[model samples]
Target chain A: MTRTRKPGISRRSTLALMGAGAVTFAAPWVARAQVKTIKIGMPTILSGRVAQLGTSSRNAVMLEVEKVNAAGGLAGRQIEMVIRDSKGQPQEAARIARELVNTDGCEMLLDGEASSGSFAVHEVARDLGVLCIHTCSEASSLTADPKQHIPNAFRCVRQGIHDSIVGASYAAGIAKTKGLKKWATCSPDYAYGRDTTGEFVLYLKKFAPDVEIISESWPKLFQPDYTEVVTKILQAKPQALYSCLWGGDLTSYIDQANIYAMFTQMEVFAVNMADYTALTVVKNLPKGIHSGDRYIKTFPPTPENAAWGDAYKAKYNEYPTNWSWQNATAVMFLNEAVKKANSTDGKKVAEALTGLTIKCPFGADGTVTMRADDHTLVGYAIGWGTTIPQEPYVPDVKAGDWKTIFELEAEWKKSKGYT
Target chain B: MDLDALASCLASPACLVTQTTSGLIIGMLLFLVAVGLTLIFGVLKVVNFSHGAFYMFGAYFAMTAYQLTGSFALAILAGAAGTAILGLIFERVFMSRVYGRDVLMQLLVCYAFVLIFDDVVRMIWGPEFKSMGMPAAFQVPPLFIAGGVVPPYYLLLIGVALAAAVVLGLGLARSRIGKVIRAAAQNPGMVSALGINTGLIYGGVFALGGMLAGLAGALAAPVRSLTPGMGFSVLIESFIVTVIGGMGSILGALIGALLIGLIRSFGSLGFPLFTEGLMYLFMVIVLVSRPTGLFGKEVA
Candidate 1:
């Protein structure tokens, strides 16, 4: 080979010289490029009955990552995500958080799971000093009181308290108009379920003083056996039922309760009955039942939401769940904060995130604001509507005033001693 | 103690009737699952950890069959037959290897199937929960029971499970092949020496167990929600039933299931928090007195 290349400065030596020159010139650029990338760690529930929660949130994050990367990445560096499955286990969630921070070198993290898992990650964030945005868990206590607040953590998901305010108001209004009382509940037996049910009932009592919670049943989450609960609710003979059962539990309850004609007698107010996935599984979703979407596209029906929904549908071949919007909103806040700070420093970005207002696709007012005090999202469109046989599950999606919610949240926060 | 509570219970005969009916219905469904577990343990000498997963497959299979044929009867047949064939294949391919091996080998095989079946479900059904769509022609409407309405579909589920229990109970005791099975369960070594082809008995019993599980799942699919981990939940309850009733005893499963069902049905009224705990309490009490479980084995 050397002899053949000797006539024309030896082909091997010529190629080697060229390669060496290229390496010499390109080495710095590659190293700089590697340094320019931002890494985010995500711990989520990626298995079991509520697997959809994590999967949807993951999809939403990927969608945002794509959008941001395509538009030249977060802070001029290419975006990278390190996702870990929590398996919906709280300890696993905490372990993954620590691993992502220590082993994976993730500068930022996202913890979007059920309350049990999310709370664990919140503790990790507090201890490890990693910036975290909770994308899904609606437990108000996670970010409510100042004494228990984690400065490193922020939540982009709608708070349970906010939902209660809107849910109770709508329920109270509906109850007043329909003259329905003697409410019962069938909630998942856990913190989220209990809190959501309690908050809704507590606020409902304040709104409609005459409401009586006649029967209450707490079925284990992901437990499909609702026969006993249905029978009890039927026996209680409530004129109306307010439930916090969501996702599969909600679907199971609806189907089981329908079998016993539980719906025929009671005016049902299920907090999360308007979800697309839940609705698809339900055979006979009565037209007049009051329902609300945690993140339904058709309800808002705005051009922005329509576009977002279409895009998400095109990507996933299904409707994006409420958690998807929540995580996407979270991604938006992250992107905006990182851009605003012009730094990937967790503390700086978090400071920028405090009280940041960003355009959201689903809100009625077209924007969502992050409150500085609790680091919770506000300005979310709030209301429940009567179901219809059309595109949007609920037609005339009743809208609520965010200002009123803001005021109530402030008072509640004050009560929590966060103010 | 609480006279007011007693009066309330007495006053609501409808509630009582509804609870009893539902309890029996649920107990019968649990019986279907637990009986399968008992049968498999009886003959195979292998604790099938994947039994719940097999039940889940039956529901999925029935769901698919119903979509294809649009006949509930055909769906039930499909669920049973499909699961039986699946069991046959699984036992032939995997369980056969571990037969005559240590308990650890058998347990490992079952666990491997559990993982495999779980993935198979996620692969086949995806992560979304499926509905077997309740139909209008489901025999009857919510039947008026005292003062409460008993869901019409519930009667169908109860009838199938009860019929299955009776047929299986009689088959295991009265039929010729059934006698061989009982013999094998009692003394597989003796049956093997007696030229009964114990392997065939194991396969048959395993297939039968799978069929019962499938039947329960298919019937439940229309009533209960179908999801990935449902098999796990039902399996937990089935385990409790088997442990309490005696692991390898079919009749014991029936009694155990009904006991748990009644507890769950009425326990919520007295102590909602302790409804689940009561099952364990019963298990602890029974096991304390009789370590081998109620119908597990005769004292040596």
Candidate 2:
């Protein structure tokens, strides 16, 4: 037999290289001996229509974890992520929350995007007295109501109420700019829609006291045809349109309106979640299609959001939407809480999270803190231009798909504003 | 209610044109998805609960093809072929067995496909939503219409759907194979008695329907994000289109699609909340007033 070993390194040398590789890999694990491994749970929509949001959230959390571990591993302990797919279902969320707390031994938890899921996780966290950091669930009642179940629940993002607060101001401003003070309201027939629209109209009344709601239409979410509603709207012919519709509904609506020149006929259109994903879907929209140039996003603090946004796109191949960014902030805050407490105990972490001040790139003033009461963060609202050309940073074919035309940094001057 | 408010909306040509174009795009997409569903239902008499699954397969297949070849057109073609094959297999192995069964059984099998396909998709594509980068040609400026830019693709989609309708319509009337299939659809027993392989005809119709669905999905891939529930949305929308257009009637499908397209365009601006409700209300009214849709055949 021909000897083939002449071209290769000695077995001893190969063994030495293997030994070195093993040691190199084991070095970090050994160094982590002194540090306690802290496990955190994130129950989120990992599948279905809003799966993208969950995936982005997970990607953002992973990035933050990598950053924390790189920087001494969250106060000398390597942080571990115990991610569970919620599939956008509340029941799945509840089951996952229980598993994370009981089976996975997670010390803290991050909330999912959907309100139902968050509420499910919130219920479990309350029962177990575990720290729950909520990012996406915007149902204000979750945080506002004290009598509700979640004792350990804390929201790290702006409530859906901010939709109304910001939407009212934004729409009023648009109306004033275009001299279109009269408006009609159309919204998905749901609590989130109703509340947001009601609040928006109420706030708009403050600015345009004489503004009239010419026509009101409430369509069921996911219903396919909009002919009757369109007929009604055309008959009324309001100068501007206000809608709290988001997700697939908004996307479908935009597609429909563009065909009928509704965008052109409506001077200004206000969608609470318009600029984030809806605008993204209709990227190659007709040049003349303009919804609202300015928006009030519940997440993202500044234009310098490039770092976090870049990190997300690098990993997920998509920009972090408002929910993704918010979730990222919430996860970082959870890690910070563990660091501040110096332990992974949920109660200790919760105590540390309460009124704990931290620098957040996702928030205005480069800083945000968990409120002792209600737990909602005084986060920023990014105003985006749905009609402007897309930016290079965003995933658009060309640079002019969308423009961040305006942003409202939700910050108070320390004592005067949100801390 | 207020003249000033309405006046502002009327004054802005940009908003109006954009909304109209948007509606047309939506309507065109609806037509694409609906026409396929209508065709399958017309010939197979199987309601096709899993029509959305075919759509999903198309999107995922297109995503894969795009990833492998980096060609949008090739990806679309691959997607359509893949879906057609899957549809043929489904017809032969599963759907064909239940051809003479109740419509409920057909729905049940398709529903099972929905679950099975969802998991299969997860295994193949993973749970993350993927985007197929738009072709370079589509990235350019759209046709200028009344000083506003209209997306070239929206016009392309409309053109494609119209061309497809015309071709399919002509083929159904003129082609020998199409004539045979139409004969079978009109009278399956008679076609069988005439020594025609009705089973083959059924499979062929199903495959064609699947291909159409795939084409719709492939076209939508660049325009819409690919997610698990994408097919469900399309399925519902297609059902609405079919019903509105008088179920199983190609002309009815086209008319219904255009009507929906126009409605969505105007309603999103004028009545956002009631957009969906209005659609269903119309369906209800149509069912109540005219059991046979505006273009549907009257029930015996």
Best by lDDT: 1
C-alpha displacement of B258 in model 1, angstroms?
A: 2.1
The DockQ-based CAPRI class assigned to model 1 is: medium
Chain B in candidate 1 has what TM-score?
0.94
- Please give the clash total of every predicted structure, in order: 1, 48
* Segments of candidate 1 deviating more than 4 angstroms: A1-35, B1-7, B289-297
Q: Which residue pairs in candidate 1 have backbone atoms (N, alpha carbon, C) closer than 3 angstroms, thus clashing?
A: A5-A10
Q: Pick the candidate with the highest TM-score.
A: 1
Compute the DockQ of candidate 1. Answer: 0.55
TM-score of 2: 0.73
Q: Model-by-model lDDT, in order?
A: 0.83, 0.70
lDDT of 1 by residue, A211-235 (tens): 9987778888787688877876776
Could you give the DockQ of candidate 2? 0.14
